[model samples]
Structures are given as structure tokens and as C-alpha cells.
Target: MRALARLAVTTLLVAAPLTAVTAAASAVADPTPITVLTSDFEDGTVQGWAGRSAETLAPSTTVAHGGTGSLSVSGRTATWQGPSLDVLDTFVKGTAYTISVWVRTASGSDNARLSVERRTGGVAAYDQVAGNTAVTSGGWTNLTGRYTLATDVEFLRIYVETASTTGAFFIDDVTASYVPALPIQTDIPSVKDVVTEFPVGAAITGAETVTEHGQLLAKHFASVTPGNALKWDATEPSENTFTYTQADPLIAWAKAHGTAVRGHTLVWHNQTPAWVFLGADGQPMTATAEDKELLLGRLENHIRNVAGHYGDDIGVWDVVNEVIDESQADGMRRSTWFTVTGLDYIRTAFRVAREVLPAATLCINDYNTNVAAKRDALFALVSQLRTEGVPVDCVGHQMHINVSWPSVADTRAMLQKFVPLGVEQQITEMDVSIYTGSGESFPAPPADRLLQQAYVYRDMFALFREFAGEITSVTLWGLADDNTWLDTFPVTRKDAPLLFDTVLQAKSAYWGVVDPSKIEQTPPGTSGCAVTYRVTGSWTGGFQGEVKVANTGTTAWTGWTLTWAFTGGQTVTQLWNGTVAQSGTAVTVTNTSWNGAVAGGGSATAGFLGSWTGGNPAPTAFTVNGTACTVL
Candidate 1:
């Protein structure tokens, strides 16, 4: 993303003094209860720091929070060897201080931590604080520690240290300061409360599990999806023995709290027991008719037992998961059940689940719905089932997205494809991972980039509002970033993917989604505006487009909204400069903070990247602020 002029790069240095520090909220943690030392490492050197072994602190170009300078350290394997800076000399001794640094490793390391130590002389008197966290592999992680200096200590050392055997690691943005209490967090509007017609939810992990505090948070969500408690392996580990013990408490808790439960997965290729597909003789089943029947019986029995047990309680069920393989020409994943029943397995699972939970919405869930090819195949499968009158009630798009790719336009386009099929859409298992790839680095991504993330969440809610009638629910994959699946899968790394941080405090992403006015928005109620749509770029099967809005009224227009329609089968895959939303054939484009207000006769434009088949006719009808406008 190009840097906005207002958020231009700075060449200035950040002071390490507590009074000079600015208090900023982390993804989960509110403001530290003490003053925080915010460091940008822009001095082009690591001075006033000591460490074990031969220490080398040189400015690095590859990894940085901002500008072109970040400190890099290599070959740290010993238990006590990492860069350390003495903070007790300048800052008050025996006061509470939290030290944090952003670190990254290519192969991941263990025993990496941040510690505050107090010393009488060169020898350490005692360790004031230490961390149990290791350097997460593949990407950047912020290691933070809070500690109060001991009265017996004369000196204090803050260590950006590691004992990991993962070879090399890079560190940046190091600071230690007094912590302060963050502002009291109030309950913002949730998806459930705002969209009364559908459920808004989050998964329960260790951080969000039922506790006195967590229970108080019950009012914040209208639905709950058990993160791992309801999976096949957790419930029915043994062949004939089914256990609801794990999920029973969660169900009871949800019921007590008036929270609807979306039962995740009656069947999944990833979590199913190996014995289910094996023959009765305790061996891999042959692809015979008799063996196929045995497998079918096993699956059907599991579904009937599990779904029947829940009965009308479970609001929805993922009857099948990732059944379409984009790699396959037929677009069907050749899982155990698929091997047994071929294309019949999908319909079979939905059929059985529907029989057991007839009133529940049975869905087929899959990820990467934003990819054009994967989407084409997924829609093909779902559309075919819907055409054949299968019991599939909704199509679940697991919108696990990154900061950069799979633009919002594509997500809308994918969801819109199912609207014609008459099935509801659900953004199940949704979370935005900050990109730490070749471009963006995260431990706290840059301010402009972070704003970009907030915009994405903001627009997603706008999109959801546009398609509220077609969407039954939008469930966040996890409650806090501390326990997200991104920590392990694809690669072990520290990430802030969810709306809340480790402390369960909502991040900027939360406000962006719930409060439209919190972000940059044009003043509401712009009347008498003219807007036109044009194709900026196009391909054989896809195209890029833009919308130009002009204030035509005698007075300056503030906060304009443009609405239009696609009579042809054209669909938008990605968009920028505005929040583009669609419901059925009608599309709504609202101004972003940058392009929201237009002076009298002044014009502003928003662009999008989209894909379509059959036709790409320009929308003929356009309205700005509810007033019809000329296309030109």
C-alpha cells in the first residue's frame, strides 16, 4: 500500500523516558497498568546495551517496523546470551516496568524471552521478570514482560534475549517503561446486537472459556462456536463409544446464557477417526461394495447419533468440510468418504445431518473462497447440490484472509454467486491475519497499514449489512489472538488476527466494524450528487472498474452514498477507495474517509477489481444520496 501523505515516514528518534512515552493499546491487552517505553530504534545504533557472548547490534534493512533501520542479532543459542539494556540508571529503580521487543526468526526458536533483572553489582541479585514465550518461527512476534524492581537491587537490566536453537533472530522496537491503566472498555455493538436477524459469534478457547469474567462477556455475543470441543475426535474417539462430555458443558453454558450454538462439523476429512474408514477386521477397507456399505454405515451412524443428540438445539451444522479439491479436475476432494461414495458422499452427509437436525441449517464449509478458481469449483459443487434439491441450506465461506490479498470485492463476488441459488451465506471461521510476507511486517504493523486493516473490517461489516437478509451469521474464528490457529498451521508465528488481544480487550478492528463514525467517514446526508460507473480494466473472464461521484447540488455534499445494479451476471471481486456492498443485483458504494466529502461540483472516485462470467454490462442506473444521476 502506498503511504498516505498524512502518515509519511519519519526520520526522527524516539526517547526512552517514561514521561515521553505514549500509551498505545495492544490487540488484546489494554494499556499496561504502568507507563510503557515506546522505542522505534531509529538512532542507527544500539548504544547503552550489553549482552552475553560476542554481541553484534547493527542496523538491518530486511526486517523493520518503520523506516529502513532495525537491529539484527544472530547466533544466540546459550541460555543467557541476548542483547540487554540497562534501564535502571535513567529510569526510577524499583518501579514497575514492562519491556517489549519485536523479534523474528526464519525457522522459529525456543526458550526465547524478555526479562527484567535487578543486580547489586555485576552479579545479578535476582530476576525481576521473565517470559515463557519462544521466538515464533517464520514471522515477527512481540515479546513483552512486566516487572517491578526488587528493593535489594541497585541496577536493572532489560533483556531482549533468546535461548532458542533456531540459529538467527532479528529484533526491533525495544523499550521498557512504567505501565499505566488503559481507559475502561465499554461494550461496543456486536454483530448479534446490531444484526438482530442473525447470530454474531466467537469461538471459545482458553482465553474466552467460561469463567466469572467470561460469563459476564456473554452479553457481548449472541452465539458461540466451540473452537475444538465439538470436533469428531473430541466427541467420539472410540468407534462405538460416542462422548458428549466435552461439548455438554459448552451446550449447557450457551443455553443458560441464551447463546445459540453453531455445531461445527458432523463430518470432516481432517478430524475423523481412522477406525471409521477401516474394516471391521481392523484393517484398511478394500474399495468393494461391502466395504463401502460399512463405511457409509459408520458415517451415517455417527451423524444420526451426534446430530440426533443435539436435535433442535444446534442452530446450524457444517455437514461437510473442504469437500472440493481445486487440484482435481472434477473439483471433489478424494477423502475417505469420497473414496467410498464418490460424488454421492457430499449429498449423503448433508442428507443424514438434515434427517437428524431437520430444523437446523446444514451447510458445506470450505476455505479460500476468495480465490477465483477455488470459488468457481466450490460454487459449482454447492450450486449443483442446490439444483438437485439437496438438503444443503447454506454455503459457508471460511474467509481466513490476509491484510493484502483476496480483496473484499472478491469475497462479495463469491458470496453473491450463491444468492442466485437461493441458499443463505455465512462467513464462518473468519479472521484477518496481518501480512508478514515479503511486503508487510507485523508485531504491530505500520499505522497506515493498520488503518488499512481497520478499513477492511469496517467494510466487511458494511458488506454484511448490505447482504443481511442473505447472510444468516458471521462468526469470528477466535476470541483473542493468543490462541489463534495461525500460531501453528502454515507456520509457527506470532500474530494478531482476531478483534481482541490477549487480554480480551477489543482492538481497532472491532471499532472499525461496529462504529462507522469511529473511522474516517464523510459527514452523513449528502444530497444531489451525480455518479458514473466505468470499466477501468478487463480480461476475458474478469474486469476492473471504478465509480466517480460528484456533488451536483448547490451546496457542498458530505457523506454521500451511491447505489446501482448489475443486470448482467457481472460480479466484483475486489475494491478500493470506498466501501462497496451488494445485495442481490443491487450494489451500494459508500465513501471512505478520504473520499467521503465532495465540495460543490467537486468529484471523487473509487476503484474495484472484479470477475464475471456471461456478461459485463455497465450498470445503467446510478443514484447518489437517493437522487438519480446522469451516467456521464
Candidate 2:
């Protein structure tokens, strides 16, 4: 278990210190930042700070915020050492001082002593100040101690010594001061700055099969695809002629949205036009050389022309798709391209694409990457391409994930292995589908599936954050269930993995975009606003506000009245530090806690969630204590 602990030292002077040292004779204080030294040192990064028992001299040290670094020593039985202060030079009697540091055992046995001692007169040995054995695993634990300087002590040393051989230690943020108190701060939030321009794009067809659900999704997404855009039959229905009418709408829509389009495929076996399968003399390519050359020529021309049309507007071209299978030699999937143009077809397609769309990113997109064998095959193919100097720029891992498919950890590890290749990795076409009546093999129920979706999205994003420099982007196949291909593919009517549901409502997965715990307010005027109002009125916070009510003298027989409105755009979402009650024509809210609520009396208690959406409205009228009050 990994752990983090912190110790804060604060002080109040009990009395005036008795002066014992002459002016200019005071000792220099400890200068080194708290450092944990140990054997089994790996590398400088925290991930490399690890311990293995056989080797001597290297132990791990964690920097601030749980980041780790390493230290090590050399000998027969290794000794791992870490010090809060490497050397301390002077001491003055009667001055109170506090020292604190955070420590944790990342992995291994926890029997170790964190010691502080004073060295007396050159080499006369040391005396202990304080030590503690109360420590827990897997979380930050604070260790602290205070002491008054003695007249004779000249040096101080702090370290960790252990009898148990195997384990790792990490320390961070060491501080020592004359004052007794420490500052407090929370972990840095992980929200990223949202940017507006769209980058990569792709389209989806079969929306009618999945209506509005798909269209709404497409509107929010970067690109759209008319599935089967370049299938052989559609692009080249005859032996020598090619056409582009079927794929124009997708390109047109993508152009209007400033989206980068992706050409679905250039070479595929399943949809080969019938003419390419036969020779001019009427013989199929399976038995004749003339037919094979014609097929290859057609394939090359198709790639060059289709990819050439859009030029730089298309960001990526799926130069080769699904070209690896377990039951193939040299890691090439069995396809007509391989059977006819042979494995060289891959190199040829890339060469042709380079000649055409010279700036577009070229990728070999594949699925089943989570499976080791398939992934290994992909690695080998990409390695061969790199060795041959093929112009492949990215590896598209088609993440068609489902519940209980590839575990998140395994998927992350699989991606990690590809980092060495030095090409951008992207999770393209991601979806988590749950089909009904598929037994336990299918995903869980909608509620559980939603939660699982949120967890997976969060974990995946966290992994992406860790590898942000290496990964360029993550693109979901569809934005909502309406257009997701999962419904018809594989014959399962599953809910598609996406941020929005069928009715275009944001799902819990949308929370994955930002931490849901941070979303404390709902947009005002939506359904359930009144119920939420009643609940929020009872809450209170450090800030305070006042309430007012007015009858306007038109409606009679009022039991009570209270009304007041807030100044500025102060939105009261969750009411902390206040109390609110509705009486007659107005609502009277009060600050019940020590922290005032949004400024008292003249201010109105606004119940709406406030957002700076480019406009503001100042209060024009107010009713305080049943008396009409105008802004002063």
C-alpha cells in the first residue's frame, strides 16, 4: 500500500528567551530540504523510486505532492538512508524550534525508525530527541517533534533505519522553523483549460439504424462519417471507372464545421468491386496474373485519387485498416490486399498517400489491441515499418471496449508498451456497449453501466493525463447512443458508450469531462428548481445574504412577508452559512453561521446558480421587511 503523511508545527512564545549567545555567534540553521535516502534506487522519477533487496545503496525519496526521486548506497547488505537535514552546524540554548516532514512506505515491510538526534562535541556520539512507531500504510502520515536547544549540543541528524530488508520509502515537503504552525493547502485540482477549435475528425453512418440521438451527437463531435464511404463497390462499380458521389455529403458537412475528415479506407477485401476480381479476358484474379495487376492498379489509383481530393483538409487517412490477425504469417491479416498485392500493398498504399496528401497523418488502425497476441503482432508490423522507413505517424487503437472485456490496467499497460515506438497513440472509435438478454456476458444494467462508464472514462482520462505528452487526443466513435454503431453491429441492441443519452440528455459520463463533485449547482429554471430551492434554503456557508418580501398592496390577507434580493451576480447554489424560510409574499433568509451570507439586510437571497455568461442584471426593485425599498 502507498501512503502519505504530513506533520505541521505551530508555536506561541511562552516567555521571553534568555540571551545566552554573543552577537554574531548564532549558528547557521539546517539548509537542506527534507530528503529521503535509501538503497534500491532506480531513476530520478517517482515511478523509478523502488526497492529490491539484493542490491545495496539505493532507496527512494518522494518530492513534494507525492512526486518521488531516489538515493542509494553500495555494500554487501545494503543500508537505505534518508535525512531531513544532511548537516546542522550550530545551537543556542532556550530557543524553541519545530521540525516536520511527510513520510510513507510505498511498497514492502514497514518496520523502520524515523530518528532525530543531537551530536555532542565533535565525535562523542549522539542523543535521541524523539521517535515514534505509530505509522499506517498506504496514506500520508504526519510525523512531528519539537525541542529546545541545549547549550552543549552542536549538530543534529535525522534518518530512517530499518531491520526488515525489503520495501520502499518516499518523503516529501520537509520544513523546519522557529514558529509552531504550518500552512495548509489542498491537492491541485485536475481541470484542464477547455479550448475551442476542433482538431481530428471522423464520420458515422447507420444513424437511422441506431435518429436525433445520432444527429445531436454529431453536432457536438468533431466530424461525421458516412460508413462504407469508400467500399470498393461504391467507389469503383466497374473495372476501369471510379466515382465519388456517395462520399460527398460527409466531406461537405465536415468542411462546413472546420473538421478534419478521415477517409475510412482505401483497400478492403469484403467490398471489392466485381470487375477488379476479374481480368479483361474474363478470368478471376485467383487464377491469372493479368487480373492481379489490374486489381493492384485499381487499388493504387483508388488510394491516390480519394486521398488526393481533400488534400490537407483531411487530417488522417486510415492507410491500412485491420491488417493483423492471430491466424496469419508475418503479422499480416488475411485480406485480398495481402492475397493479391501481397504484404507490399501496405507500403504501396502509404507511398501513394504520401504522393497525394503529403501532410495528412497516416495510420494503421486496428482492434483487439488489448489482446496480447494481437498487440504483439501490431508491434511487430509497426517495428518492421519503422525499420523500412515507412511513413506511419500514429497507431490508432480502436477501443471498442465492453464491460469485463479488457481490464483498465491491462489496457493502460498495453498502451505503455507502444510508447517506445515514438509515434503518437490515440484511442480512436471508443465505445462501451451493453446489449440486453446477452446474459452476464453483456454489460450491467443501465445504472451500473452508467457508473462503470464514468469510472472507466475517469481512469482512462487519468492515464491520458499521465501520458499527456505522448498522446495527442482521444476520439469517441459516436457522441450518443442514437448513432453508435454498436446497436446493429454484432447483433446486440446495447446502449452505446458516449457522453449523452438517447434524448440528448447529459449522462453521468458527461461528469467525466469535469469532476462531478465540483458541480454543486444546476442551471436555474429547469425542472425540480422549486424542490431544490426548499432544500438549498436550509443550508449555510461562510458568505451571507439577506431576504425581503413585498405585497405590493394589491393582494390582501397575507400571514407574513419577507423579501430581499442580492446585489451583483451572486448565485446561491448550495446554501451554506445561511438559513431561509418562505413567508407570504416574500422569502426571509438569514445567516445562521459565523460566516456572513452574501452581505446582510439590503442584499437579496438569490437561489439561481450564477455563471458569467456575458451578461449581468442589477436588482431594480426590492422589498425588505414588507416595506418597499429602493436601491440607495
Best by lDDT: 1
Best candidate according to TM-score: 1
Candidate 2 residue lDDT tens string, 1-632: 00000110111111011111011000112111211222222345332322223444344453232335444322324334433344344222433343444555555435444444455456332322223333334655544433343234466555554445534455553434332111111132212223122232333532211223224434455555444555556666775476665466456656765655666566655555666666666765653466567766777887766777667766776777788886676777766667766667788878888888877878877887888888889998898887898888888787777655668777877788799999887666676654323442221123445566766666666666677667665666654443345533444233446665533445566566546543222221111111101111111121112222212222332133234443433444333234555333233554344423222111222333222223223334444334544331
lDDT of all predictions: 0.64, 0.48
Q: What lDDT does model 2 reach? A: 0.48
Q: List per-candidate RMSD values in Å.
A: 18.6, 28.2
lDDT of 1 by residue, 1-632 (tens): 00000100000011111111211232123232332454456677765555557756566777675456677766655656677776666555323344557777636466566665555445453342334455665666666533443233476666755554636667776655543323225556654566565677876632243332254247567887776556777678888688775577667777887788888877778766788888878888777787888888888888888888888778888888778788999888887788877767777788888777768998888988778888899889887887787888988888877667677788788878778878889888888776647343222223344456677888877787788889999888766554456543444344567676544456677777777567542222244555545553344566546667766555876688888888877776667778888887888888898767677656677778677788677777688878887554
lDDT over C-alpha atoms for residue 356 of model 1: 77
